[model samples]
Target: MGTGTGRKFLFVLGSARRDGNTEQLARLAAEQLGDVEQRWLWLGDVPLADYRDVRYPVSERPEPTGNEELLLDATLEATDIVIASPTYWYSVSSSTKRYLDHWSNWERVPGFVEAMAGKHLWAVTALAEEPHQAGALLDALERAAVYLKMTWRGGLVGVGNRPGDVLSDTTALTTAKTFFTA
Candidate 1:
């Protein structure tokens, strides 16, 4: 199952509930990634503090410690990044939003933006409504990838609300089989 390309994938889970529909969908897609290296991080497990807008003061960005450092290292080590977040109010969950906000701080690190450039970004989301309802969530991730000069590999949208509901979405299941292959 090895791709033998030395590609490492970082799957960032942003769901409030463990084993939620969004994470399940992400796992389905990840299984198709073959033997490629994969790491999973749940935002809830590594609680990040609220991002403070320090750009206004033009102060030095302090080094990241604790869970922040762990996440930073993981992001830097990965060749591909998968953001697995559930759609809340037609957008990403609060934890996902907070994780992206931390990117602002990371960008200030020396060569951080350069390291992020050309990396691949993918999105996975489960929405309560139709698949089209994930438009906002996908747009946000796509914009972030564009801003970072990363390749946008599109997204996998699953229709679900309750626990395990996403498994019932045949369309998503079929797409998950080859989502990462592209």
Candidate 2:
């Protein structure tokens, strides 16, 4: 089950609740990635401060600290980035949105954009509504990937509400078995 491809996947879990349907679905898809390195980062655990628009102020922003540093480093080290977030109001969760907002600051770091270019981006989401409800969330991620010059590897969506609900989604489970196969 070893990929031996040196591909590292960074799974950013953006759900408010631990072990929620979104995380479950993401874990299922990740299991298909074989022995490739995987790092799971729960957004709640590494909370980010609200992003500030300092670009126009001629102000110098301090270096990233605490969880911000951790996340930034993990992001740079990974060859693939998986945004694992539940569909909240037809878009990404607040915590997840916050993490993405920090990308603007990261972009200021020398070579950050170059480092991200050509990397793989993927999404995994679960929603109480139909899979189509995740369109906004998927579109945002896909667009961000393109902006970063990363390859969009598509997304996996599962319909579920409560914890463990996605487990009963036979269709999702079947897809999960081969979601990351390619």
Candidate 3:
């Protein structure tokens, strides 16, 4: 989609460390999305517990922590959503997995399925190894998008074991600029 103020982009970063490689790459990509409103959600700050289907009766209802509600609101408000994470042992980080697991609760929410349909979903991941090392994580995110009926807008994975190492990857930098510019 064209980068314009009319479009809203929500970036959900799932890295455990502050200012980690994943966050840096996600920020770089967001910067390329010119003239658009951007919202950053650090999943590390979100206190997400084990996924519990909250639509159960009051007696069986999960604890009333508002984190899920807040996240869901931000997600539904955005036209484009970026789920960024650091690859952990060939899978997504714990925070990203937990956040995605919560999607099942939305199935109980009225209109949630309809609201998710047709929205755009993008993936961003950073790993010390090659991008291929993160294949499973990418596949999981893509499948989630398909299951939710959202369009998968593709993904970017940068190699950076150390802080700011992604800055040296010209391919990732160029890809972010070109992808968002379009």
Q: Which stretches of candidate 3 lie over 4 Å from their true place?
A: 1-5, 54-65
lDDT of 1 by residue, 129-161 (tens): 999989988999999999999999999999998
Which rank order by TM-score, best down to worst? 1, 2, 3
Candidate 2 per-residue lDDT over residues 1-182, each given as its tens digit: 36688889999999999999989999988888778999999999999999885554335867789998999999999999999999999999999999999998888777889999999999999999899889989999999999999999998899998889899989888988888776
**Candidate 1 TM-score, C-alpha based:** 0.96
In model 3, the number of clashes is 0
**lDDT (C-alpha) at residue 66 in model 2:** 100
Itemize residue pairs with steric clashes in candidate 1: none
Best by TM-score: 1
TM-score of each: 0.96, 0.96, 0.91
Candidate achieving the largest lDDT: 1
Q: Which stretches of candidate 1 lie above 4 Å from their native place?
A: 1-3, 56-59
Score each candidate by Cα lDDT.
0.92, 0.91, 0.84
